[model samples]
Target: MKRLVKGFAVSLLGLSMLVGCTTQAPGTGDKAAGDKKEQITVGLAISTQSNPFFVTLKEGAEKAAQENNIKLVTVDAQDDPAKQISGIEDLIQRQVDVILVNPTDSAAVVSAIKSANHANIPVITVDRSAEGGEVVSHVASDNVEGGRMAAKYLLEKIGKQGNIVELEGIPGSSAARERGKGFHEIIDKEKGVKVVAKQPADFDRAKGMSVMENILQGNKDIKAVFAHNDEMALGALKAIQAAGLKDVVVVGFDATDDAVAAVKEGRMSATVAQKPELIGKQAVELAKKVANGEKVEKNVPVELELIKK
Candidate 1:
């Protein structure tokens, strides 16, 4: 009887030890620190997702956010400055760890950026930049360089001596300003090449078609067209085709899928490819670094590629 009692006691002791080994006290294991990883929330305010480029940009940001275990709250400004301002304010109210903005208008977004600054939230601008207010970082392709490449390509196709139309993007946006500057820099140096018509399409396809139609009515001698983005380029192509005009070279920026397909079909002469996805992903990474109190560069530029047939 004494031996059996001792054996039972030993078995109980062994079971208790096994249970203790399997079940550790909360916050006392190798995974305690990992399990307690800080939950980060990021806010993204985009100018508009109506554009395929911005849509792709949002996808990239979401992918990075998922990979890093972050919660992303996104708002669309619908290309309205006031709406963009309101969106930023909403983000600030949410107490997000970081804010990422794709400004509708560089100059107009200053107040919104300042609002974020006042709230002590770090701001990272993607694609378009703000004209005022403090931004921790900016992620985008070199618009000036992309524009220069487009101009050079168009000039080469047209023999550097032809009437070309310039289709501008939204006014006051850094992309439109910088791209125009770079394009004019090259076109100005060539004496034979003249920009016969320049107009703003607001980066809208229908607007681009209408603008091109109006320009074509007055300038039938146009040999090529340079649009700020592929949406406009495709619209211009439609107008050109409707007019039964052939051999007119059309170059564009932001080589979206449709634009690339057009290039493959020989509908467009060429396009400057900007990786919207990469830009968004980098912006999110930068925002994460900022949230973690890590230093980041002022500007992160993704490379641009020329896509042609």
Candidate 2:
């Protein structure tokens, strides 16, 4: 009977040791789970996803977020200022760590930027900028220089002595304003080049085609065309082709796939290339830095090049 009791005590001792080794103390497992790193969430507000350029930009942002283990929430404004404002407000309500915006209208976005400022959320502008808001950083190509490059190339191709139509982008957009400014600055200096017609197509292909058709009705002697974006440029090309026009030099900004193809086909004279993907990637990187209380430059300019075939 004594031997049996001793053996039973030894078995109980072995079982207790096994449990002590296999199981964690109460609350210890919960503490370990809580000690894991918290995820960072970023909110991206794009002007419109319909445009391929913004699509590429969005892809770049997504790639960066995935690589860095970040949680990204994206909303499309559909090129509506009000929609963009509401989108940002929604992101704010979600308590995102950072906010990135590609404003549809530079001036119209000021109110949204101010709202973000009030919420103490860092705002980073991508591709486009807000005219009157406190932005922590701006990531974009030098659009003015791009405009100048387009004008110079077109003038050279057209011999600097012909009537040209200017196809503008969306009104109140920084891209349109700056690009127009640069184009006119150079055209104004050349005595031989004349701007027969200038109109806004709202950075759309169909609108560009329609606007060009109207402009063609009054100005049949147009020798060249400069569009603020590839969409409008492609539209203008269609209009020119439909009109049975030939030898009209077309210059467009944004070296989109269609634009590059057009250039190779000799339909477009040239296009200014902006790295949309790089802009998106850099914006996310900057947002991450800003969210982590790191200092960064106020303005980061992406490089630009002129593509011609």
Per-candidate TM vs. native? 0.89, 0.88
What TM-score does candidate 1 reach? 0.89
State candidate 2's TM-score: 0.88
RMSD of each: 8.9, 7.8
User: Candidate 2, overall lDDT?
Assistant: 0.91
Candidate 1, 284: how far from true, in Å?
A: 0.7
Candidate 2: where is the Cα deviation over 4 Å?
Answer: 1-37
**How would you encode candidate 2's per-residue C-alpha lDDT over 1-309 as one tens digit per residue?**
999999999999999999987798765544553343367799999999988889999999999998888899999999999999999999989989899999999998899889889999999999998998789999999999999999889888988899999999999999999999999889889999899999999889999999999999888898999999999999999999999999999999989899999999988888999989988899888888888788999999999999998
**In model 1, what are the clashing residue pairs, if there are any?**
none
